[model samples]
Target: MTFAFPRAVLEQHTAFLGKTGSGKTSTAKLAVEQILAANPAARVCVLDPIKSDWWGMTSSADGQRPGLPFYILGGPRGHVALHDSAGKAIGELVATGDLPLSIIDMADFNAGGLQKFFNDFAPALMKRMRGVVYLVIEEAHEFAPKERAGIGAENLAIHNAKKLATAGRSKGIRLMVVTQRTQALHNAVLGSCDTMIAHRLTAPADQDPVKKWLKSNVDKMTFERVSSSLASLKTGSGWLCSGEAQVADLVQFPKISTFDNSATPTDGDAELHVQTAPVDRDRLRAIIGDAVKLAEENDVPRLRAEIIRLNAELASSGASQTVAAPQEEIDAAYQEGLWTGCIPSWTCSRT
Candidate 1:
């Protein structure tokens, strides 16, 4: 199953929407996998507020081989437990340091805590990011709601998300928002994405926005066919609506090379799949070195254990470890990769 869209979407904003169990995460991971493979120095940061198991990114498809190198933050599988107030420090680390694929698991947070964390994190990340970064926010509506009644916390969260959507591009933050509740996602945020990979969405309000976009951007037949088929689209299959590329495709995204941790588990599945692709601890340190230091400055006790753990890893890593290319070279390659990420699946034609 191969899916194609504008290759340049790597540098822009994207929205993945559908109902639950409709393959939104699968397609999102497909793009992330492609980006990492297409660009070796690729840096990705994911905010999984739902606390989903993103650690699978480091594992191979069969869970037998070492997968991509990833930094796990504040979860059951985390290198260090997350401190609630360390959001700014964490944000600054990702902004300044060179990172592999990293997931900030904020499942421990309540709504207020979640907003407070992003309140500092999102702005700092948007401000200090150096090289190109792809920011994936899963369950985006939880961050930027159309109308969530709360104190200033919810409002700030929504505003920050909108800022990421509107102003993040200049600072090299390519945002990919994943959500099942398109009806609840803010209009500004949803409308900002030029590429929309839609999965099964049966709700009328959810379909309304796609319909409106299709009405003006696509031809009448395309609008009708796509809008009518949303209710019946099969799992792991849907439409790719990119008005700019002029492609409204019926697509089944390619299978991910990594484990599908997002897949819902069946009954009696007691064996936890914490297994990830083999990890390089020294490489992981290169990404989290500054973060550990920041923890020390703030006197976060949990990270002391991490510092000791990493020291052992560094000593054991030995001479087999390799040095990465210089930052300037990596940046150049990233810019070049932006134009070629989806080239393998791409085609040019006039409708």
Candidate 2:
């Protein structure tokens, strides 16, 4: 059965919670496809905290056709390098620019770096957005954890998440909070969601949020029926409960249009090999140049700035030649930072 998403469901804040191999991400991707199909001009931004399969959005389900041209920022497969400091700038860019699908793939970052990025990003994106924007926060629990270590960044992150839950609707921010561990996430954030699509959640703790949701939205008998079935729901199937959509149904998601790069390989499967769809190199490079500028010190921005300065100088001198910055300069800057051990902000800022 094909699960349909109403605009009421899409525009309002929603939570997608499930255990591993339960097809939560794929279900979210189905929503994305539906949204984009409904409004091709809709702005969508995905923040994948790890080396996730969101890159599959660039390829068709068959891995043969060109899918959406989502500009990826940082990862082993990213076009632009990502840094913790870049969070503030990236968030603003997503809000202010007319860019295409933007995916912030922070696979290279550690736990401390993730906290720093979320600290800077959540507030910036929340404040800068003026139009209707759809933002997907994968691994939402990590950014808005129930247990924080009393770190300022972690506190700020949860603060911004709570604000996003409470105030983001009036500001035209459509959010999807996706996580495997719903109990680990902030209650206020999950509770604030108008809709919750929960797949198979086996653990009692993990099923707590859905239980709370069901109890509040449905009759006692209905809630009991749904709660009992939480652990045995089929893969790709979920209970779509939403007050706004007026939906409470067991739905099955259809096949996604994009490649499923996140699928686990079985023991008998051959070594995985994939070839993503094609893109315009020149155009993509131009877009990546803008994303590259989001990075701060000891990064590509300074080097690019120096190259621009040299190009302007050449132009003023009536010279037709322009040159890129030397490799030695970038190498020297990186080496200096490495030796000094100075990037303290991203290393967790406890003091």
Candidate 3:
């Protein structure tokens, strides 16, 4: 069955869980494609441990027109210095709407380096952008583990991830975490997700968390039925559960128009060669410069004042000022000049 995700849910937290070869990555990419396709102004940043998977989006294998202009950071030969000012500048550029869809491939770095990179970049990006940006973390279990005992820099990375998980929504930084091991993932990160898309999962470790999360809306009998049916789920099929939708259902994802660069390589397959392109730094700077000019022309100070007033009203009512209000109210506010031009429409109202 077709499952339609609301715009509110798209701008919130989402998780995709499944075993290897169960289509977790594909499903996550499908969600990203859907979001960007539905909203041209929307942007996404993918953190891929393997650099090759998302290259298809940058350029087609068959030499056709590319899907999106992706600026990639780090690769097989070397990594971007994430802790340095140059690295922070990249984050700032993205935060300021310079890069539309950026990919940070961690294949070049070891565990320690990857941890440092996340610790440095996550907060920087959060500080720069308010919202309308989607950060997709592939293999999330490695970055935010349930037990961060002795990984050195990884501990700090986990802390940074947890902080972002809890507070990033208010700033419009939405996370889409994809992982094969559900139990190994950090509890804080999983608990923060508003939506869960689960594929075939047979192991009790993985099934337990999904079962527990689903228990809120699904009865024991119905849950058992659904659990039993999960074994029969094929690739690209799963259940979509979220508070935004009234009922969860077994759903099959539609085929993506772009190439699946993340496809698993088969034995005896010929070696594939592809060239990596550098990011257009000049163009990115110009984009950010134009954005700043637009904000100035739109009277950002007045917009900020209106946002502060709205936030105070929400807080006095004992509701989260960061959470969106109802869509109707936001629409009315926009008409009445109560809405701010800076905030995203999705976060304008609680859905």
Q: Between 2 and 3, whose TM-score is larger?
A: 2
- After superposing all C-alphas onto the true structure, candidate 3 shows an RMSD in angstroms of 19.6
> Residue by residue across 253-338, what tens digits does model 1's lDDT show?
77777876666352325225445655566666555666544433433233234444554565588732223223443344353232
* 28: Cα error in model 3, Å: 1.2
Tell me the spans in candidate 3 whose CA falls farther than 4 Å from its real position: 1-4, 60-63, 76-87, 264-351
**Which candidate wins on TM-score?**
2
Put down candidate 2 lDDT per residue, 168-214, tens digits, no spaces.
88887888989998989999889889999989999999998789888
Cα lDDT tens digits for candidate 3, 118-204: 777787888888556888888898889997657648778888889879988888789999989899999889889888888988788
Kindly indicate the candidate among 1 and 3 with the higher lDDT.
1
| Most lDDT-accurate candidate | 2
The alpha-carbon RMSD values of the candidates against the true structure, listed in the order shown, are: 15.9, 7.9, 19.6
* TM of each candidate vs. truth: 0.78, 0.80, 0.72
For all candidates in order, the CA lDDT equals: 0.74, 0.77, 0.69
Q: Worst lDDT window (10 residues) for model 2?
A: 342-351
